[model samples]
Target: MNESIKKVAVIGTGVIGNGWIARFLSQGYEVTAFDPAAGAEERTRLAVNHAWPSLEERGLAANASKDRLFFKDDLAEAVSGADYIQENVPEREELKKSVLHTIDQHARMDALIGSSTSGIKPSILQSDMIHPERFFVAHPFNPVYLLPLVEVVGGEQTNKKALEQAGRFFSSIDMKPLTIHKEIDGHVADRLMEALWREALHLVNDGIATTEEVDKAIIYGAGLRWAQMGPFLTFHLAGGEQGMRHMLEQFGPALKLPWTKLKAPELTEELKERVISGCEEYAGDQSVSDLEAKRNEFLVKLLALVEEYWPEESQAKANI
Candidate 1:
């Protein structure tokens, strides 16, 4: 834990917000959270309970406890004394700005504010704030408690020291903070994901593959390699002795082929129902909670395996 950031506040209780709360509690941070929705506190507690087993498997800080979470009805009161605040409101531009303005007004001036937005740029999100310099995008993956990657991006007005502190704080909590020097829509991971998603939708819409088939393609093949070395190094290995240089020389022309439709297909009613029914059929008897539990267990084991093979030096080189 960053000693300068003892108290933390989470300013929403949606899926992402609850995930953040679970992670903070597991890391032994006292978290005060606010959300206006009725029964928000109950749902958050339930989410924490659901995620606890995974956190325990990952390992817990000495002081970690679910009881450290406090629910406050008033947003101002929730943020007033916090040294770090995370905003995870729904992805409406106007609403996020309004809520951020309120947090900026109430939080301590030195408090570092991070938004868990999936796509919005940090500069636009921090534009209306008085202390915009302290604000940045801290976009995290779903299942935030178990997933270690957090994309840390500073806004145009954001201070270098603020980004540095946020990186250090996230690192202390057992997270891999990837600081993005340039901001773009969907940051880094999500953009790559969105491209693949668009292509997957196109395949489904064109009747080329079923949802289950698409999933199987990734699950049995690229997903396994991606889990460790990611796309570049995986492709590099394809070059045999020559590595990436020879691989690119042989396959680079394939990039110009019409192998992908970058634009996403429209979500017509037929497509929507096909997708919903396909997923439901695939899910069969298992509830979402059941699947989540299984996924968490798998990830805990996979993460352990990943750390063994994907050492820090290799990861740094891959990033470069």
Candidate 2:
């Protein structure tokens, strides 16, 4: 990892773009953002300010001597000397291709570019880039400053060095980088999450439970276990001394039972209303900002617990 990679450019100023800026700036990177949209500079500044306290609370902003940040109106100026570039524009293929094409013509050749794409494959995202090897997907969850996971995916044309450099860069910022071996739709975490989401929707549609109850099923039960250990590891523990293989052998037959419908339910108007109403009811007296703050607090504490207990295979990189 290069300690000298102090400059980064963030392209786009939407919600995700603000998140990328927060994560980068909190890690002491001098972030320069480019977003031609009206009020983008103000929005980015507000997001960064809001994130600063959280970063300080986590001991991530120990080095405050560095310049706070910079916002650029010129795209060329933003990418001119950046060590890395993070693209968080809308998920329009043509728009992405156009932006990357322009960036390819302007950015430093050796600078790494990452896309905050949730579902798009890197191959498709970088098809038109002049230097595709320097570009790849570095998808991070919402509120990137809180969630540490960054899924790094390389396309067929992606440079190995770029991927390795991305891993190092994300680690330097205290992020858990998971490199996908192949280009797959939705990558890893989202795919697993979508599967469960489909079932959750199905249950709601079938009137098996209200949305709040379904949320309870997660927050009050298996979700707690999942936060500490993955499903396989949790099941291994469930099997006691027998471990996963033994548990699988014993439970394999029951797996065929019609427990869950993998099919997703249609987002009908009534279902949508039900979900909205359920959330509104759950919210009670809390405003959206208050609820969000509470949620973020829980996530930070939960993740800290995970790090303390079930450390990842790449735990050594956390100290970088």
Error of 1 at 190 (Å): 0.8
Model 2: lDDT of residue 127 = 93
Q: Write the per-residue lDDT of candidate 2 for residues 33-88, one digit (tens) a residue.
A: 89999999887787777766666666675654225678888999988878888998
Q: Positional deviation of 179 in candidate 2, in angstroms? A: 0.4
Compared to the true structure, candidate 1 yields what TM-score? 0.97
Stretch of 10 with least lDDT, candidate 1: 311-320
lDDT of 2: 0.84
TM-score of every candidate relative to the true structure:
0.97, 0.92
In angstroms, the error of model 2 at 160 is 0.7
Model 1, which residues run further than 4 Å from truth? Answer: 1-3, 313-320
| lDDT of every model, 2 decimals | 0.93, 0.84
Indicate which candidate wins on TM-score. Answer: 1
Q: Per-residue lDDT tens digits of candidate 1, residues 1-320?
A: 13398889999999999999999999999999999999999999999999999999999999999999999989999999899999999999999999999999999888999999989999999999998999999999999998999999999999999999998899998899999999999999999999999999999999999999999999999998999988998899999999999999999999999999968999999999999999999999999999999999999999999988885656556441
